[model samples]
Target: MSLTREDVAGIARYARIALSDDELTEMTAYLNDAVALLEPIREYDLEGVEPTFHPIGSLVNVMAADDAAADERALPLGIALENAPSRVGRSFRVPSILGDEGGAR
Candidate 1:
């Protein structure tokens, strides 16, 4: 498949790219070269090759034991929140992101 200068200009417009006439001309040649290189792959004979999603076809999660030194390195709630800038009951209080009244949203 060959691409014209018009085709490249249209592609640039669709992609929201601002290109000078020189740049459009250059990119037209570059994209046509890329398309021409891909044309040779069409000659590959694949009569009965099954399509695959992954190179390593059927992998499962290879999980190990969760011996993460459970809770020994954990900080207590009061100690963790000791220097908090603002707090409400047991939780940190910050500006609401939703920009709604404090009741529902």
Candidate 2:
């Protein structure tokens, strides 16, 4: 995972970027340092540990109470369309997605 100046230059060329010699040297050092930091994690043993989606244990909702049957309120149609920029009759009016032809191909 060690990166050299030549490797950084090759990467810049492949990405269509024009980097000065100083920039290439700096990028090479930065990438090498990043790889060095990750190298130790690759060797650590994780035999029986479960993969975590979140780093904070409290953030995971392991026992979320079921409130699915709670009374739900619905917004009136007039209130819903109140903030619409454009509306035609009972529906919102939007620009045609079919372009000038006015229908799907």
Candidate 3:
């Protein structure tokens, strides 16, 4: 489908954006050109192809192997928290925001 000047103008009005006549005309043509670029994808014949969540079907969870090695090389908790400006228990303590009453929100 193609877009017209009226369609662009209506969208701008709904979005509460004020555009000059030149801007409106220029944007309408610009959007139409963008749409034209994607038009060729409609010609693809994929009736028998199965839809996939990802483009690469062979992708695997590489993180599972890394998790084992990560546990062996992990830094001790005491050393990791040594340079922290402030901390509470096992986590970093950041200043309260939005005028929080005090402790954890």
RMSD in order of candidates:
10.3, 9.7, 9.0
lDDT of 1 by residue, 28-70 (tens): 9999989988987788887898877778988776975677667
lDDT of each: 0.84, 0.81, 0.85
Best-to-worst order by lDDT is 3, 1, 2
Instruction: Give the per-residue lDDT digits (tens) of candidate 2, residues 21-47.
Output: 788888999988888888888897999
Clashes of 2: 0
Error of 3 at 84 (Å): 29
The candidate 3 region of ten consecutive residues with least summed lDDT is 61-70
Question: Model 3, 44: alpha-carbon shift in Å?
Answer: 0.6
Off by over 4 Å in 2: 45-105
Question: Alpha carbon lDDT of residue 77, candidate 1?
Answer: 81
**Worst 10 contiguous positions by lDDT, candidate 1:** 96-105
Per-residue CA lDDT of candidate 3, range 1-105, in tens?
A: 677889999999999998899999999999999988887888999899888898899998665454655686677888888899998899877877656776564
Model 3 — TM-score against the truth?
Answer: 0.41
